[model samples]
Target chain A: MRVQFVLQEIWIGLRRNLTMSISLVITVAIAMALFGTGLLINKQVSNSTNYWYDKIEVSIFMCTKTSSNTSCNKADATQEQKNTIKSDLEKLPQVSAVEYESKDAAFARFKDQFSSTPGMVQSTKAGDIPDSFRVRLKNPEEYKSVSSAMLGRPGVDQVVNEQEILKKFFRILNGLQWAALLIAGIQVIAAVLIVGNTIRLSAFNRRRETGIMRLVGSSNMYIQLPFILEGAIAGLVGGILAAFLLVLSKIFLIDRLQGSLQFASQLSWSSVVGIIIFSVCVGVLLCALASFLTLRRYLKI
Target chain B: MIHFDNVTKVYPSQNRPALQHVNVAVEKGEFVFLVGPSGSGKSTFLRLVLKEERPSQGHVHVAGKDLSRLNNWKVPHLRRRIGCVFQDFRLLPNKNVFENVAFALEVIGKPRRFIGKVVPEVIDLVGLEGKAHRMPDELSGGEQQRVAIARAFVNRPMILLADEPTGNIDPATSIGIMKVLDRINRTGTTVVMATHDAAIVDAFRKRVVELEDGRVVRDQSRGVYGQAY
Candidate 1:
């Protein structure tokens, strides 16, 4: 009837079943933590994909004096030929930016990019580098058009899109994401059943009280609300614990694990906050559902 | 007030009916006793009046509501008018005597102000004024039953159905419980108590209804327990 009356009953019932309540809270927290981790990783993968995808460019390497391509001749490209190629690429509607790199400039860029991998840089000679045009497209999907146009040119050796490599990386991350989601789903279901059964036992133990309440003209809502609130209280506690665990994981696990992987440093603060809120909401909703279903059969009030 | 018209209850797996074509009536403010040996349908009769079990055939009307026609949602409202005291003294063990008494009012949404006044008054009526704060486990069998009686009467129900209210207590304690019931009945509340205690039955000598093998064999005014046979 009154909110205070219902709350009082909930408090008393929860106190009587302290062990069951604690178990429910722990189970919910663990399950929500696993679920939260999976979601966070999925979010990180998407964020990183967007970050890298936007920066990806198509590289067209031109044949030179020592190149193996048959289209290349002994003489290198003249300044007019280089200007013509850059002008043609820039004229295309899809081409946003086209920058040419000379053999020496390309080599220097390669050394800068692979500065940490000195062994890789030393194994290759400077003349082995080819002059190339780095073509940035307005849309990454136009990479195919740019590649087709530049592939058969007189001085072209090959046209390579770095987005293909990123695609392969994303495929593997996606697989791991699904695997984590499946495991998280199973744990959530198991947690729900555990909470449901615990509430069932509490309902069974207090069946006489429920029966008396029914006899004394208590409404179905009045009779059931206390048990529902009990489950929700357990869920609330679990949610708090889950938020704590997620925050701890972000601070300790993600932050520390980033030291081993350079890109993981990009995991954002918003992602951590999102995981905490999402985990707590899931915990509360699942526990409420479990309590509702479990009480339906037992409480007949 | 209560009325039964040819009510029959056949429990699952039992060849004979628990109650067979039984008919009885009790008007407002009347005190009646249902006396029978164990397994004679005394409990079943009480349960039927409360709609705990619907009659297999015929109608059970209590407090002007036809229980056979009543919806599930309406059953609680029906029960609100009829208070029940069980033989086991079904008190919530965790609750103190005062809480146990207050629970009845709480369930019906009585405001705390009303509960504060009515609970102590009912506790005093049951001679439990000093033990209001004692838990059920802390009380003796007689005191526990008294607490149960207090809970039953606190709501001022229109009809009280007490099933063996004094069965577990000694004769002296049984007398104390009988006096409490009498006091409640004096306030114009109908009391239907089912008991097998013949000594108390003879001493009270109120209207008695006797049941045997799912049938009413005797109904008399100021009757002894076994005078019919």
Candidate 2:
């Protein structure tokens, strides 16, 4: 094949349909960016789940003098009740380890956790946080057993499983991921249709050339090479744009979310780069394939 | 170099067969004029030689290969050995005359220097020497047809098929076009041209095969175009 001839043909085809080509590039870029974002959200969700699942602990808060529960009756649990509760939690197979936090220690831990916000630290008194037992489960999924056993005990005000809260947060992240992927799916369909339309129009415009080529014994592949390369070039440009969009999304969207949420693990730069490469490849392949199929129908040779 | 054995062509949408039970042979270096009315399958006969349309029931052999058995991938190879010209002078409107002629070689992957040498030579042969830089729109109908013929003949194929090469040109201009085809025929390329011009046929006195309503009514050697049978 004459490389220069094919390249010249591609240049002519693209220039002839400049507006359509621009729109095709933009559509492909949006589709690929959303696709990359979906993948990034997928990565973020998995990273957070891995980072947080292992550290999940079920907290069993004991009654204090301020507690008005039926079991506590606005009185602090006695020493015997505390011992009994801690011993019971330790006896459960699901409970791996138990650490008791006194009221003063709980208040100190709260201050330490909220140290970034001085207003929250200043408003919380020592007695505001009740004493609690932090239970680590061998299997986080078995938190139900430990929580059920500890709830409504004479010394216990309430039991909370950290994994449940994490599940809710992760659920929201999963919804966002699905939403991104869904929009990406629609955009991909749009991009593919545009690629097909562009190819058909180009083929129609150059029907005279192609007819002459067919008469001169030019092979089908020789005739199709320029059109296919046209799509691939458009795809390459769009993919480059999408790479920029993906990087920006990581910096302004994901990293910012991590900054505010403070629990999601950091997404590595290398992984973002990897996702960018994958999205670009997908864009190129999709465009090439779409044009190829379109040509098969519109171009007889 | 071209043979049709009991050939028949039937299009799916029409009840009438385009060409029916036709048998004819044109040897190498023969200039044969296929004289027929509009629906008499003159174009179909030329199309069969180019493998553009297949005979629904018979066989077509070009360069001694059975066209029915020719694989789809091998069709281009078969077409490369045969040149075809259409009534429309299917030249790329955007390309100049030289570029249009060179496009044939370029599409088939000919080298630049080789195209540079042969394109102008063929343009000179077709009597379009200094008009190489003009586009199709700038050239007259006869000049455009000459460019189309040049493109078809550039690769030096063994056979040339012309379907109404003079269909749209004036009589004076068509005479020039026929002279070009005649010159190409002298170089040992078998030329089968379909035309309704009885005057050119009688003037050339080449072998004439006349068709009427899909069947060969007469085949005469060095014959003039006869009246409708």
Candidate 3:
């Protein structure tokens, strides 16, 4: 109940175990930093998924003069075949939009994509790429409906779902996010153990004081208050350090991710700020809870 | 203000009961000495009154409340009314004598102004008047015990329990410690002390309750410490 006394006790305990407290602070900082990074990665993956899913297209290539498929019959797809294909795709409910790309337009796109490579642009011929229907589905995952229907169709050379390739990239990012989270989880456990050890040592050091306090009619809450505050203060310092680490990670890790993967949108500063707040709170609560549990087991008042 | 009705105490780890079928009572404002051999449950008697240890079989009552039924949360409140002194004089090594005594009142939420007024009075009562600022390590064994007594008595509790209050001090200093306890007892607080000092026990001529192997073997007024068996 005495603020001055409790504060004094906390200061004494922290000072006595200065090395241990410093280690505890560092452990908590690293754990919270990793946790924040994991959360940012989660946000990055989801943001990219949302951004790229909208642009995903399923391409249905039509037969060319040199098409090898038995259904192509060694002849280019006629205007009638193209019209029937376009009309059938439009009729399907899964299809949101269908745009026909002529062989000349496909060639132009290939040249534009490989503009930096002069040799690749010069070697590609217009007719080499067959005409195709770029089908945008209402749901990217619903590419299966269109692909299953168009496969082996007369005049169709191949049906390629763009989502499949994108899925592999997202899967790798998801794995990375999970790895960050897993390491963060382990670090959190380590932080908890350190917090527990720190509190136990503090309690042991102050056992005489606690004993005197107990005999003098101090409640269990009163006896445990200083120890609990010591843990919380250490957590608070660690959380602040972790906030700095999170800022560095946002600038170095997430920013670099956005730079290399330009197709995915960058994680906004507001979301990073939100994750920082959440991770700091988690750090404080985790240390406080660990200290409380450790006292319950070891310090009997 | 304390009563034990056929109390039996058996710790979980030990097969033998520390105190068996013990019945004793001390009236309010009484100074009683619990004299016995080392393992004869003298310490257990003081602990039971303080509610530090519960009786296994029979009921232990202090200030008219049965301790067996009292809630664990209420134990601190009970302890507030019972001052305890140990042989080792358990003082906060980091705090001075004044802060040590004030700690007792501070823990119980006493006001700063009130502690400022009362801590000096209690310190002076235990004859540590101007030595308030001295730390525990600086004080002698007798002065440290007096400081522990000051801390215990700062709240003006209804009962005082001293477990070997002079066990660590010399014969001359032990007399001074006993005098302080006697003065506190004169203030109408019930004092129950457990001791092994037969000379002081015989000199005091107070109510003596002797225990041998956890049973009350003698209970008499103005009694002396009997011969050791």
After superposing candidate 1 on the true structure, give the runs of residues whose Cα lies further than 4 Å from its correct spot.
A1-5, A37-56, A63-96, A103-130, A152-155, A245-275
- lDDT value, residue B68 of candidate 1: 84
State the lDDT of candidate 2 residue by residue for A1-301, as single tens digits.
4999999999999999999999999999999999999999999999899989888899989888787788888888888999999898888988899999999999988897788899999987898799989999898899887888888888889899888888898999999999999999999999999999999999988888898888899999999999999999999999999999999999999998898778557999999999999999999999999999999999997
- Give the alpha carbon lDDT tens digit for every residue of A14-73 in model 1: 877888888888888887877787787687678878787788799988777777777776
TM-score of every prediction relative to native = 0.87, 0.95, 0.89
* TM per candidate, chain B: 0.97, 0.97, 0.98
Give the interface RMSD values of the models in order: 1.6, 1.3, 1.4
**What does DockQ give for each predicted structure?**
0.64, 0.73, 0.64
In the predicted model 1, the residue pairs found to clash are none
Per-residue CA lDDT of model 3 for A1-301, tens digit only, reads 4888889889999999999999999999999999999899999888988888889999999999887888898899889989999999999999999999999999988887788789988987889889999999998888898999999888899999988888888898889889989999999999999999999999999888888888988999999989998999999999999999999999998898776656568789999999999999999999999999999998987
Question: Model 3 off-target regions past 4 Å?
Answer: A61-94, A100-133, A138-142, A148-158, B227-229
Top DockQ hit? 2
Q: How many pairs of residues in model 2 come into backbone collision?
A: 0
Residue B81 displacement in candidate 1 (angstroms): 2.0
